[model samples]
Target: MSAEIILKANHISKNFGLTHALKDISIQIERGEIIGLIGENGSGKSTFSSIISGVYPATSGTLELKGQPYKPSDTMDAQRCGISMVAQEMGTLPGIGVADNIFLGREEKFTKYGIVNRKEMYQEAAKAMEVVGVAGINPADPISRYSLEERKLIEVVRALYSEPEIFIVDETTTALSQKGRDIIYKILRRLQEQDKSVLFISHDLEELMTVCSKLIILRDGVFIEELEQKDFEEERIKELMVGRKLTGDYYRSDYDGNFGEEVVLKAENVHIKQVLEGVSLELHKGEILGIGGLTDCGMHELGRVLFGIEKPVYGEAVLGNGEVIHSPKQAIKNKIGYVSKNRDQEALILSASIMDNMVLPSLSKISSAGLIFKGAEKKFTARQVDGLSIKCREITQDVKDLSGGNKQKVVFGKWLANESEIFILDCPTRGIDIGVKAFMYQLMYQLKKENKSIIMISEELPELIGMSDRIMILRKGRVQKIFERSPKLSESVIIKEMV
Candidate 1:
């Protein structure tokens, strides 16, 4: 990384109406450097990056790019100023082709006399897709035709097409599979080779440590600490980010793999066309069944098939009582909970209030004569808010206002409030900080102790080995191997089957 300063934030602060999103924060970015930003939800990490990328005008701050005063009117202006951001949330436009989505703002190249040239657009889009290592996707197909992971990869390509001087990657890996992640990492390294800079924001500490040359910690909208490449350590960075020392094993250290013989949930020959092929599994009472795989291995689709969110052309997902679940309502009625990998799009209602979202799954319990009681609902919501320690202004606070980690907490709170007996958590700790991730692991452990079953599908191998009673490795939509958890189980052993 070069010693030259590329971007500088001077006393930056942001506010949304009455809420202070960012405090007086100052930081510097060096050319040819990958900077990692770490903090808990609502901690101003995203707020700072957003301000720098011109997503919103900062409440107060001064910015300098390449040793000059830089103030972008908007995201487009920022892009023109050689700064680009890949947002935490999905930003692709629906109903458009992949090519159109990648080149959304740069359409002038394909326009002639105010008319768009479709053939050229498709060709350019395909080239970008290939450059990003995305295969088997038709550029002419609608963006909606692809999965969430594919869409995220497309966005990465979009950001790179312009070759911006500085790139902001905001919690994007949560939406990606391993293949997509590898491609992104390669792209970042290549950017560094070109002496460009990257501001990488993620909850995955290991990833940050591996890729970042510098680390910045933020808390409750305040700057905490900045560490050099030599100072990158998982536990230390985690402690600094949370503003307290973590006191226990991050994952359950116990090796008691014994679980109930009676199965709580079972998937039999489940199939989702090309996505999942005859995938099957059994979740016993009190067992954490960890599912591991690479992208295109069907682990994600398997979660949907088992939860009744995606209808399977073959086989069944059965409850203990021989009742087959065919719909989300049926799964919920049977005490089954599903937290999708794409938390923002598939799991939570971003624009709704905390109270409304918390009470959504169990509306029947809080309603009388199809009329809801606000007092009773607020009480129920408050319990979850306290239980999960969700940082929010009020129960009436919009979920969109909360940070990424807190938004995930709201999703967990919803399921916990419903008293779900069987939980299907896909990338449950994807975008959360270490403190919140540890809490989530504790919750899973407590649930296991209570004899509730869990199916944890994650790209994170450590989480799988740390918490699962048994691990199932998948490849190309088929079960490759299932290993009983032991002290000897390691990521290397499980990864052999995954690839």
Candidate 2:
């Protein structure tokens, strides 16, 4: 039986001045089939999608939709062609409710005499939620009250409401819970029934395997292989994405951790009201401590509080080695580094140049005798950039212009340049490509080799299990379980404690 082709991208390539983002990428997505786009960070999945959806026009290529030549000059044009992309980043107004966000531009359709038909919109939203199998969220409640995952769901519902013939979802599921992801799978199943196509992107290859029909692997901004389900293997996929056979699992020391004399971190009976309890934990030198649990578990709060971005009403974190970092500024001054899960929010200063961002943490460190030393600063950042292999045309490029993976590398550079001994990383590889993730893992390992301690907070059980030397599962602002080392680590083990 011949499959119906919904979209074809032929010889698609995009370049940002000297940096070639996409290279003659060609792909055929069949009608009603889910195509998985896989690549390492800066490998060009998003760029390809951007070119197809008119976020940016292709440098040179042809995009055919339903056997008709299609060139989306803008996002609105893409929408008109029944091709819509739900960006991983939420652009929702914090004051607006889910219903309004879902139907923002099309609110005029539900209006009567130029007045909003709120009740009708709510009813329609309820039906849409029902279709998408989401619950517990009030359409009337302000979007600000929602969790990161809930906001992501709202974004999904918003994009899906347009009934796009071809839907592009980029790295969205990491924010959603198991139940929420199931809802998305159900929605995609429904879309499949309607003969709609989807370009599904995620770092979770295992999850993609369950949902996508074929996996198109990209490397160095080029399409390398289109792997059929029959040929799908985790090791093979990882190898293809990284362009090398991985050595082991790319985690820290697999053996039981050998505790050092110095204390790296200490939090004493910290309280954050309803969100976080009187939590206390101590970290040692050269250790990678893992944190995980359900979405409501106080792990995120704990990270924030320890970092001093969120103040605690009670308790204090005493650094084991006497580094006074009670406030965020103090924390930065004391050489503590942080990479947030919400990449766009806490980590990136999008409007700033890459070099500026890379030195943001170490600005004071780079200056000497009350003078800005450009040469020394450049030398410091250049070394880290080379070590991290930052994928940018130049350090002067805006951090916003870099891909998710490269942007993250810049965040790492900012911290690494500070020569921080203690690092806090939250979902560091969330939206990046496998290659970039591999590099991040290697970087983490390298940091450990440098005898630096790290605290890794994540929702993905695999990364936590595959990486951390110590595992701590937080449940309802309390430590449910803390495994001393990799001697006892598994997704099932962590999941058992996390919930």
In terms of TM-score, the best-performing candidate is 1
Across 390-447, the per-residue lDDT of candidate 2 in tens digits comes to 8777777888887788888888888888889889898788877676787888888778
Compared with the true structure, the alpha-carbon lDDT of candidate 1 equals 0.89
- Which residue pairs clash within candidate 2? 40-435, 41-433
| Clash count of each predicted structure | 0, 2
| Each prediction's TM-score versus the true structure | 0.95, 0.92
* lDDT, model 2, position 399: 85
lDDT for each candidate structure: 0.89, 0.82
How many backbone clashes can be found in candidate 1? Answer: 0
lDDT (10s digit) by residue, model 1, range 320-419: 8899989999999888889998888889888899999999998988898999999989999999999889988899999987877788889988988999
